[model samples]
Target: MGRTKPPRLDGESEDDYYMRLIQKLANEKLALFARYQMEQQQEEEERKEVATNLLSLKKSKKSSLKRKQRDFDEDDVIDIKIKNKKKKKVGVTTTNKAEQRPVVVNKVTEGVKEFIKNKMKGSDLKLLIQKTLYASDLNPGQNRLNMPANQLETNANDFLTADEMRKLTDKDKKSGLEVDKDKKSGVEVGILGPNLRMYDRMLELKIWDMPCTKNYVLISNWYNFVKEHYNFLKKGTLIQVWAFRLNEQLCLALVCPDHEDDNVAFEENLHDGENDDVAVAASASEV
Candidate 1:
């Protein structure tokens, strides 16, 4: 061998052994630094390659844009000729008439009209609001029915007289003017149930005008009306509210299309003078 090797030590406490161990660790550190430098150099090369490729792609895009512009100019000449031909044929092209579909009349809505005419003897009946009820409408604590201005089937002004409309839109509330109960900025309208029977009391229809939103809400006796018709006035239930004049008093009919059968039966009972039980129940609800 190249010079006799040192005798092996039982433990690594010998000076030669300690020197060898230190040399091995130093070599490992040097190898790690070499690998780190290689990785950094490789990354720099990759970055330069990517930059050069991007520049080449940008130049290619510029050339393509010029080519497209030339093609577009040629196409514009062709498009002008095509437009001239289309104009010549414009008068000869006959338009197809839209197919007319059969109008489907809702039976429940027709029934409501009949009820107003026969039972209530009401006139000027019109669909006021058609909307699906939400939790706010059925909430007991709220004790009111909200009808957004936009949800009205027709113009809101159509439903009220000039004086009534003026009262509702008046800004006197901010002036702290004392308003009489009869002169309050609301119309007291009687509420009819889905069965076409009026509630014991009337509900006040008022405009709730705020800075960002406005609504026509029914207050005062709304809680009793909801409690009486709780089963049919749940959330998500679609209802049509019809406004009419009964004996010169403003009245509304609440109709549920799904409960048309019940309404038919109630109407029959009323005609046969056999609705005494319903009348008694209605009186009890007042209490």
Candidate 2:
């Protein structure tokens, strides 16, 4: 007969015995390996789906940024074209205005100058030209002491006589010398000489000639005269001043720079002296 089958445990059926043996065998080996493999495959599939979604999101962001940049570039191009057109319009308007503006000319000044040129006499015109040239050549703070030759040669008697002055002083009468006197007080004309100085718009001149002795004249009048001939008034220049005392103060009635020809001669003499000195020095050096 065949080998006898193993006996079952107490109270165990034949099917229960086979099922327990199989469960014990599976526990000893790999019982749930197929189930673990199926779970890993599911996790891999979820990771691939997440990666694909992230890639699509990145592509959409890039495309949106490119579209925004393209719109901005088009707007910039339109703005640049509009500005260029406006500038061209403004330039055309300015050019038309400049072309329409009229030119102006002065005729009165030219006519007046021509009239003066025609009216002036020969000797008078020559003298005037000389004076104008001299004045033009003079720098500020420098002066030319030039007077009419006739005025310089006038005798002291012609200017004022003692007898005439006495008559004018006592009687307040007009003299032959045209010495102006105040009618209220009969005063003789006095003379102001060289060494004149201006102080605070007041001219103070020392009196050395005529009847006055050791006196100084503070001239308050003749502002216009002084202003007109200001360039001629120089220090150490001979100024023949016709003045009279009013309230014990000398009032300058008339004044003029005199002896200009003599001053010119003196300057020439000085220049010659300087030349002589230079010649002597040169000769001495040669020796």
Candidate 3:
């Protein structure tokens, strides 16, 4: 045998075996080349897999970063909006405070003085009122004959004090009336003590029309007349009064019994329209 030849590929076609001798001459080199090509292909596949994993990780990181950034931006916007709203509220409160102003209350006594000055222009009534209000007659023995009405009315405690009188005079300057500021009613009513004696104070008679509530002049010097007709100033009798500012003292312009009609006969009556149940029961038994 010529050096033993390597076995041929079985069932080799003419094309397959055409360069058999040449192939056999470089077989060792060819085998080495084939192994090198296979290793190169395997390395390429491993590199592609590694690159894909790295790319996926990078993409995930980028997406996470973008999401975090977006949330941060939204939070920043919300914070800015809240701050703006607070600023607006503060501005409104400040503006409101600036707009508000204090109200000025007028002195009540000033208006009454002006009214007295205007109404009693011709008469020396203003001087008399001043004297009547301010005259201090603590010493009963001295000048007892010319003492003020206030001194004569033994129940001075039942009357308004000096400070109270000041407040009352300062309450409503336009109307010399100590009106019920809370009630806002045009009509003002007050009860006087039984021992009240009006010696020099001006007085007028006023008749009340229950249906119309209109005051009609009936007579003057009503208090003086009450002394003569003692029955007219009876207990629980309703009287209409018009208060005035006499000097610095509170005075009444008119005071008279309230009447539904002109048949002005006075008698002691039950207090505050209260019915006498005993009298009614007695009448029933008589019936």
Candidate 4:
């Protein structure tokens, strides 16, 4: 008999090894389940808080004297930037001539709207957007989460209430032409309510909160004209996310004003200009 002794039980019985593995797997699964439950509970608590904050926001009447300085200065010029490079040569305008107008477009996936109805917040939204952009591999650029500058502003507008809408839109009603009959190829708009009534509140908000004053009413027209009706949603804005998310939400915050900054106008007349080129191309295509 070798002094090696009762020899380590030879080898672990295959069944015994399998039983131990099964136990380990069960414990891991239970831990994961517990973690998920905890996360859900935490999100529910956050949602409750978001709802309370938005509902509690109220505008108290006050006497006003000094008006807030708008982000854009008196000499600032607004310029239109068509996303397409080809259009840039032809459609993008640099000069303040031609009476530029702003256009607004708003569309939400049926799936997304459904998600909001249930309750959501900035953190949850951050996850949802991450899941989306990750799959697309698209970076919205310096704006939060690499989103388009305009889209950044649009997302922030999700915070607007009905009264806000009315206040915002009023200015456009006063400033823009009614255009009961749309021109063949002119500015088109989709807005919150069917009637023009909602714009007053929208005007007030934009004129104040949005930071640009010298830029024509195009921004206002775009925001107000595109909504069916504004609903209040309390989420950190693209700006808020930029400052808070350590710039992770960069895509959500970057916004392009419909036009260039006040200092550099695109030089609409520098060349014979592309407006003529667009007209020629469009005519040729129609033909």
The Cα error of candidate 4 at residue 138, in Å, is: 39
- Give per-residue CA lDDT, model 2, range 122-205, as digits (tens): 011111101111221122322112222222223324433465345433442455342322211232222121112111233433
Indicate which candidate wins on TM-score.
Answer: 1
- Would you give me the overall lDDT of model 1? 0.60
Best by lDDT: 1
Question: Per TM-score, what order, best first?
Answer: 1, 4, 3, 2
lDDT of 3 by residue, 81-133 (tens): 34553465311211112212222112222222333345321112221111111
Residue 254 of model 1, lDDT score: 82
The candidate, 3 or 4, that scores higher on TM-score is 4
- For each candidate, what TM-score against the reference? 0.54, 0.17, 0.17, 0.18
Model 1: colliding residue pairs: none
Query: On a 0 to 100 scale, what is the lDDT of residue 184 in model 1?
Result: 47
Clashes of 1: 0
Write model 4 residue lDDT over 7-82, tens digit each, in one string: 2245778677667767766965764553344334333433443343334432232435344775332123111121
State how far residue 183 of model 4 sits from its true place (Å): 63
Residue 12's lDDT within candidate 3 is 79
| Regions of candidate 1 where Cα sits further than 4 Å from its true position | 1-105, 173-184, 261-287
Q: What's the residue-level lDDT of 252 in candidate 2? A: 29
Error of 2 at 243 (Å): 13
- Backbone collision tally, model 2: 0
The candidate 2 region of ten consecutive residues with least summed lDDT is: 121-130
